[model samples]
Target: MKRIAIVLAAMLVTAAVPVGAVTAQQSSAESSAYAGTHVSFDASENAVTNYTVDGETVLQSVSTSSQANAGIGLDIALSAVTDIDASALSLGTTTETSATVQADSGATLNAHDNPKGTLVIAAGDESQYVTANLSGESKAEQVDDSRVVVENDNRTGTFIVVGDGEVTVNEEGNVSADLAEDSRLVFRSYDGERTAEDERSEELIANGSAAAEVYVMQENGSTVADTVTYDEQTTVETTSDAKDNVTMTIDRSVHEGTIVMTTVSEEALAATDNLSVTVDGEAAVEAESYSELQSAANGGDNSAYLVQETSADAESNVYVAVNHFSEREVSMTNDDSSTTDSTTADDETTSSSTNAPGFGIGVSVVALAGAALFARRRA
Candidate 1:
């Protein structure tokens, strides 16, 4: 009996060793610092427990959690800041300027410019899989399905959460969503230099300085319009028309840089095989790539190029690069008229009772006979 007990004890101890090792591995933490800023990542919690600037605690703790079949949960605590937190599944790399964390379910958290103090959280799997809790003096307002604006009472900074998912911010400023992959939430620290009001009021379709923006114009005038500021040198207003033939207009009077425009059509656009772009009513020349477009635009030539087209949804999206912008309109040429004409032609061809061609010939023959009879009578 004693020998049997010893053998069982040995088996139990061996089984316990691997569990303890995994626990230690999951509990490990990583730290990095840059430009008077410091960040610490806790692997066990999959969170940032400390985010400090100039030795002042700007963030207390940012943690993540998950439930069965759910994406991820995020909870943040700010020191002399707002209460916003995020939770993920695991901790990734930690660098001086940034730290990354990811969830097994594909949610990702990225803190960039830790020295400058910016945090951006994104969905990895294109699923609306991230939920955030907002507390303290912070107030969150939902701008649209893809945008949420969080502001604190002191107005020291602003957090903009954008994704292709349904974003909800209650009166308490808590944010929750099952965000699609690549959807992002960004936090920008103004350090009391700028107020939340300084941010544009329009629905932010995209911020050129931060990331790409996608806008879809419907038949109704209710389309997305935004002011995009690039490189701090150019501000452009983007708007679209409500017609079947959608027209995207960019006010590039004060623009400077290469602008990329991508479009998808249900059918082939009129007059242009790939994509159409016009500046001041003149067709702009096409370049080979975005780099070429940028070079041409910066070198005083208006140029454009079709980069790619994919025929996935019966038609492909066309990517165009342009170097200059001036009274610019990006659209399908006569899209509505072409569709109408094609439909009309199809209907005419299928109508057996109309006999349009025969009717035309009969009318012509009658007119000629009447003219000949009148001439003979006169003679």
Candidate 2:
């Protein structure tokens, strides 16, 4: 179901982008200091880092190394911008633990809210062993055509979209990749300077872990359109078999929209047990579609939703997982659109504003175990 939705979103984006549209290829910043001029993967390998901005070599690599930590771990550089209107911006990682790219003096990486402005964080190459750990940030008019593609090593990566324009990941060229353990991909849109380390707002957590108490946040407004929380209980045949049991806690609050936790075991499968769910304290039933989760919101503040699952089998090894998650619907209006909106939860009303350009559409797929997954798309 998640794949189907993503395919449909891709189709919509392919149709929306006009032919011969200008892609984000420029790297110009009026304020020379704000313009990204150089990038490094790590401080130790700075001399060997290779980077370019607008066809100019800001840094030259002295050695060609592919070691996991070879060269400057992760970095980028941009040439001085003579014209902001002709420039485009992208932020990603090759080997750096984290990086940032900014446009100062009210200059946006992309002109207006053009979807063509892209931000990408993907495997530097297609080789399975060529895993790269990268996290990046950039100031753009909007973030829609960007993507984060990973294959082997589960490295945490995040992308931030700043300004009145929101992020639409489903725009043309946006793609989703299956995430590995401990891997997090975030796409955020904010009005403030989130570049400060102390002001980070996104995170990924596992169930039963030390960080389980943490709650991931998104600045500006909540993008989580829906959420699901349930419990799965099964019996175990033997105490040892419990070691193989896998329990996943589904968090629909993060930017990619889903956080999964899986348990490993030293023992083999002992037995399987029947399972049932009680959504929001209701009777257990199969959800025909994710819309049911949205209905659970009750028209309140549905931005952040939580679902918990616990399982036990007759002989242990009881596995519980969610079947689906709904994407947040984006309300895009003309330039005159106002941010005067409210959501009521527990008889309490919360108001927010989003004076954005038109909306961008996209979808993100999150996997649990055995290929089971959930889907989230920006409305």
Candidate 3:
């Protein structure tokens, strides 16, 4: 049986309730910095929430299946001949939400076409993923460690995170969607990570020009003490004790902002050999199995994995399993008659402080053990 952690932070957000359409718009005083630009846009959503600048719709009704989508919307639009810029932009929704943005330049360059809004997803039993798309130049600051303040200087866009899911901010300078408590937010820009002052002080993973920053918040919306590890490599000795058995290696890495889990076996088997693997309790097949898990463990990806390999001779069978998570605290247990196993994380740890940016999305390590059991059949 799966145990649901009773997180206090997860309880604070008011569950979404049915509500009527709400909208708000704001205009700025003419600025010498942004010359030859006129602000114009039209933005509306379900039930008719709208924001317009100079007769153009920028933010529109965001379409999603989550009930948390019902709320107020704000839209701002601006135009320019050569370029557009702004120092500060602020708007509010009827829900009394006042989102503000301040940028060094080009803040309103694409206000009419940029995507903006909030989307909330509740935690669930299956694997899922979501992205927060914010356009223009924007910055997100964690104010009072309760909620993230994301503002864009240029375009109108929507952003959100639901329940205990993870949100990845892949681009630099654009704001990521706001995540409620009990969620994880991953950043890919080196600039954002610099502002975050990663607590573990782990060297930034080089992604050519790509940058990243990670955030993991508790149910109360406060930052938690967690480490983001990447490219972690571990090996499990499954048949060493059986006088003859195969070896398994588990390599964890990130690609295009997603967790790529690849498993390789030492036993060189013919095409007829039988090998089976299970990730997070889901069955996988063959000598090599590659699967992608969520970047954050708040979802189901951070769980146990089991691998079994049998040779053509059928002399012995080997089994291996690992449980993964992203917290400092860890627990492990296993009860099987056969198999050899060991697990350790080479990832570094940073101090968790609210004073520094300390924002980056990373995964956790959970319980894991090695034992050999008769291949139990699932009835």
Sorted on TM-score, best first, the list reads 1, 2, 3
Query: Compared with the true structure, what per-residue lDDT tens digits does model 3 show for residues 1-379?
Result: 0112222122212122111211111122321111111222222221111332223332321111121331212231110111111122222221111122221211111121111122222222222222232333455543322233444343322232223332333344222232333232222222112233222111222211112111211212221211222222222211111211222323333222222221122222111133333443444322222221222221333432223332213212222223342211111112131253332111111222222122311111111111111111211
Q: Model 2, clash count?
A: 36
lDDT of 1 at 352: 15
lDDT of 3 at 29: 32
Top-down lDDT ranking: 1, 3, 2
Candidate 1 residue 18 C-alpha distance from true site, Å:
27
Model 2: weakest 10-residue lDDT segment is 108-117
Q: Which has the greatest lDDT? A: 1
Q: What is the C-alpha RMSD of each candidate to the true structure, in Å?
A: 28.1, 24.4, 24.6
Better of 2 and 3 by TM-score: 2
Give candidate 1 regions above 4 Å deviation. 1-46, 49-68, 71-88, 114-116, 143-145, 153-155, 193-379
Off by over 4 Å in 2: 1-273, 279-284, 297-379
